[model samples]
Target: MSGRKFAMKKTKSRRKKWASSQLFYEYSTFFRKNADNVIFQVTSDQLPTLNRIGLDDLFMSKGHIREPHWHPNAAELDYVVTGEVVIGMVDPIRHHLLQFHVTPSQVVFIPINWWHWITAVSDDVHVVQVFSSAKRQIIEGSNVLRKTPPKVFQQSYDVNAKQFASLVSPIKETVVIGPPDRYALTNLSDEHPESVPRVVNHTPPGSPNLFFDLKRNLAVRRDHSYLYEVTSTQIPMMNVLSLGDLYLTMGHVREPHWHPNADELDYVISGEVTVSILDPNTLAVCNYRLKPGQVTLIPKGWLHWIIPYTEDAHMLVYFNDGKIESVEGSDILRLTPADVFQRAYDIHAREFTREISSITGTLMIGPPDRPRR
Candidate 1:
């Protein structure tokens, strides 16, 4: 009886299969940690919808720092949600430093294995970091220092063993996020004017900051939908990934399309959307109705479309590859050999040609002359 009870309890503790009913997640309620700063994260372990990607939201107080760290398995795309922050990254392969004074609505990408850190420049700074993988293995600077053999450190820079041990031995615990030893609240009224929070507007030379506003002059802006995409054309130095923000009005749809070069991860920021994706190989379709704080992942070369469920739907799309090449459904249908399609459908060639001729260009966002059944 006791053995049977223990086995039943173990089975009950096992994780359930990923289900469509579990597609929606409020990442704010995910795991969070506070040690001078607050960091919230959602991973595949927490929400299977993030099986291929993960996200972190850092809330940092003034003078706090998200410690220098590197992910062994993922690159990072960071967007400043509010206030200001400074990001410093070291290029792993090239051995060069990239620094940016990032502000609201700005973005930055840190390649995998690149050491990077963020510092809060305002009293309340919030940043969202997107990872390319579901589980990011972080190697924090403090952990690295603590794990290094004393003899290796003594031989590395000619530091004596006693001093090296003294420096690292007292660090009893890791500080994932912290302020400098002397960090204090700045009061402009009682201190020098320079003590007040100031904007960080510099993009150091050679660093080529990949910061762009989503609402800036867009690549495509229509009456019902608009998109702002960050690609090599906009920021030359970046090649790790491309970021895009898309907005659609009520009743509007982001037409069926497939990206040839990249898989897409979509996060709904506001409003609701019904997303449909079809896999060409198996002809399998996955459809979901996602609301604010929900996300969907579409594999590369899968046909997909998004229909707004509310007015002013906004979403962010991230692609692994830096370059973007989308093949729209309209383009494929309009350019298809009319006679071939007509024969396949057993329709008149002229009628088929005339029916699709109206699709002159890509219908990026569409009403389709009528609702698509």
Candidate 2:
């Protein structure tokens, strides 16, 4: 009785401390709107539990661009949720300008500090950009162009000082989305040989694969539950970030497991789910019920599981490492000797062995058979 009382007291104390740890955030509430385009961000500042990971929920209309920019502190993995986009980036190492036309379910990865920009190809373009750092620091090209003296352009690149100044005069401030709202929209399809660079099929030797289609790669499928994953193995350019697109029906559970090499951020796309994480620091189980547009962060190596509360629950799970390594609870139970468990916990060895005999391999989803519930 004394031991149980002490344990209860300890749990109460830990709960007090854990109460301050925020694990959920709504992306819709805190967003930056630029005319018709909107950018919703979730970083450590918004979700205090976030560590070494963040996301930007981008929305743009046709012909608009997510202005030329680069993240100095984080590598980015951009996944197209709807419509189409043309992702352009300058490879710093090779000094080559690379561009990829991405469609729905496709993704483009940008290495850290690489200058990149996204232009909407179809109307209502939606892209989810995941970052390696909790707080991604960006340097916008508009600021660089508008802030730098015209004389510097002439001195550095041999451009006419007055012409450069006049060209950039319209850029009044940081243009998150371009061309600024004040400027009339132009026909992007109109070809201007002088201004538009010709598209070429140039593949340099040893170039990394930056673009991938998640829909083309299905990791696993069981009944109504399915998982699609993109990792370094799929896209070599991906270094610090990967994604797992998961769907589950009611009674389905993303079985208890822990990523040994990466931290996970779960963003709900539809329906509802309960993300349960075992806090290593507090040794307490914390469960967060999430709905669409909500997110939860799970630290690396923390035992966690997900159970869908409603049918059609879809989640986008982002990891800090390109190569994800997980230790499944099913694997642990199946691999461990029954005698070892019996010796440690003073249980019936033969009964334990018989109980776990059905678990032959890794069960990413619980209940090998259909759930009666």
Candidate 3:
């Protein structure tokens, strides 16, 4: 359970299926130590979000060093996305350092409170690490950090602070977070041997398991709201939505109606749900008991409802379409039909057109010109 005392408040319209208004960070945990955790890429259903989540063509740096730290709350899991990493953890009770220089061509797991460190070998290490702490969670408690005075931690061990400093990096390294500088750690790699040859982090699923968890991509961002804390998003200039936060929630009764400008892409995050869609031409209702991974497309301009089966049924939804984004949702729900949305917002159709294209945004020129499948 998240030890965070903060509550996941209902900040927006309760009528909506998703609660996506203010929360920022999906979650955070210690990275840097487990190189294998950095590289694993899995299907979207495995993610807590119901929408599309992707990481394409990212190369890990060789000098890359993870901070030595542990989190008070939230457990951590890491998957080796690409390359190999030298991992070491302090297992005080076992009376030996619990360290593994691993090469999981696919994935690796890191238990909570495992104060650890990771570094790239020959290739840039790619990893996928997940956290369940309150947004903005950082490395705290029982840590042998880069900033720990070498003199203080030394004498007991043969390594002194200066030599220890050489072992830990100060570029990407941080007392907490080092400034984002690309540094080369040839010195460290010489002492710590590299791992075995491996495949690129992207390995297709063996049996296509729909239930693997990809919660490691989550991070905590204190600057933003809790929901959005540490969470990052991309909005393309063409109005094409690349990644969106989508997930499902279920109850026995028909859900309240809500809409946002962001196009919602949905699937069963879990469980079964009956959905009702209302457009000008049709008011159609479909009930489905979606399992672990199922996709349900929700077109724009259609009012919809979800009737959940299990008391805790869930679904994944891409609630935001680039054209009709969060601002659109806020405008639609907060404003009246009589208000001129463009004038009140001080934005003209041309302004919007310049920012987004008619293709992706589906400009209100007349009838929508969306291509049919």
TM values, all candidates? 0.75, 0.88, 0.34
Candidate that would win on TM-score: 2
Q: Candidate 1, after superposition: displacement of residue 101 in Å?
A: 2.0
Tens digits of per-residue lDDT, candidate 3, 221-253, equal 112111110111221221223222222333223
Off by over 4 Å in 1: 1-31, 34-53, 91-97, 149-171, 180-210, 214-217, 279-284, 348-358, 368-373
Alpha-carbon RMSD to native, per candidate: 8.1, 8.1, 18.7
Candidate 2 at residue 329, lDDT?
93
Candidate 1 has a TM-score of 0.75
- lDDT-best of 1 and 2: 2
Off by over 4 Å in 3: 1-59, 140-373
Cα error of candidate 1 at position 6, Å? 38
Q: Which window of 10 residues has the lowest lDDT sum in candidate 3?
A: 1-10
Worst 10 residues of 1 by lDDT: 6-15
If both were scored by TM-score, which would come out higher, candidate 2 or candidate 3? Answer: 2
Q: Is candidate 2 or candidate 3 better by lDDT?
A: 2
**For candidate 2, which ten residues in a row score worst on lDDT?**
4-13
